[model samples]
Target: MASSSTPSVRDHASGRLKRAASTLAEDTQSLVSEIKKAFTMVKNIAVDLEREKESTKVKELETLAVQLSESCDNCIRHASAIHTVGNEYQPTSELTDFKKLLDEQFMKLKAMPSQNDRLIRQFQEAVWNVHHKGQPMPGEEEEDIVMTSTQSNLLNVKCPLSGKMITDLAEPVRSMDCKHIYEKEAVIAYLPRNGNKKQCCIAGCPKFLQAHRLVCDPFLLTEIDELRSMNQQTEQAQNVEDFTGLDDED
Candidate 1:
């Protein structure tokens, strides 16, 4: 039996496991934040072809973010299990030290650069496939190919419910159902809070809208900004041409 003041081996192991899980969760969250920041930067570049490539890279980053999030959830689950088992069951002589195992695995994960390499390889392969029309040279192995966005799936920036442009809305969200965007508050108001389904605001659309289906679309918001910037520049150039002709006439 353990002394009253001192923790038993089971209790000590449980505490160590909890700390390991907590550290993993925090670090995972920090990595997610960094990914978001990098995503924003990638979206801000002006060239169209470059933007397309960056978009592919961003998708890969998003996948990595999702994986890291799942890993964090698993860590939390494992920590909870450790707490439960430590409290209820007797600590056996051959009981696994999950803390040591997690620490070893976490250190290995941190040391591995294969994940980063894979992302870069996929990004490069996407760019190559785009340029080459997905045909590989005679000796090379086949790589995964990504298709460009088709015209029919593109979403208009204007909100279907309020007729407000994406740039004008304080918070814009996209519907995963019909690929339509809406002003977040407007759409929320349009749908009943009681969880009743509502028809999509856009005419001729068959999909139903629910609160869960609405997602924050940073990519759409970025596209809207790019479009607005291009339009402004075109108008400014036209104004310059008109002013030049007026001066010549004078």
Candidate 2:
């Protein structure tokens, strides 16, 4: 009789674990979906780099991003189809622990794109190398020349929000989330009027957001100043252009 009861006890524990795993797998979808989008951004950057002229490093990152994306997609199918679970419902402490592990993986996935952005923003030598591939990295004097060239190109560039070419960023504001800089007054006025739902105006911005708030971005202002000083001074600015694709705002 004791031996017969031992089998029942073992089966009970085994069934509970299976149910928990199933629930955790279902919850993992939301996490994995966001991970998919981030990898897509990496792929877009890779394409842009290719158009500009590819760097070996950018290609390597692109390949890695694809591998990670496919792996995440496979997990959804594999985890949900576990054949070990019983037909009945079971919620146990085991399921709770399994869900926590999924949550940790979710955080890790979120950080991956941020890591890529940091590489682009801070270490643009990788991007410079892409354009200058075939030639040695620019020396100090060469870098100065490159800087002058870059600044000159931007002088004619107009603010995306206001078509008027910006000579100086008297009050520069960058999207806190997206990092797309716009003239302070233009964005500040646009935000509250749109129910405080501001978005990055740049084309194909990865981090466009329903901006809840705005803050001064001095770094952008400084860069604008350098560009402004390169040419004749002008205090006049053009009127804010009609915001395209924002019909819902009215």
| Backbone clashes, each candidate | 0, 0
Displacement of residue 96 (Cα, Å) in model 2 is: 31
* Residue 72, model 1, lDDT: 36
lDDT (Cα) of model 1: 0.55
Error of 1 at 151 (Å): 9.5
The C-alpha stretches of model 1 lying farther than 4 A from their native spots are 1-154
lDDT of 2 by residue, 5-103 (tens): 776775786666555654665466556656656765776677577666667857686567756655654454334333112222244434345444545
C-alpha-based local distance difference test score of model 2:
0.49
Worst lDDT 10-window in candidate 2: 233-242
Q: Pick the candidate with the highest TM-score.
A: 1
Among all windows of ten consecutive residues in candidate 1, which has the lowest summed lDDT? Answer: 144-153
Angstrom error at residue 197, model 1:
1.8
Considering only N, C-alpha and C atoms within 3 Å, which residue pairs clash in candidate 1?
none
**Superposition error at 82 for model 2 (Å):** 50
lDDT of 2 at 139: 58
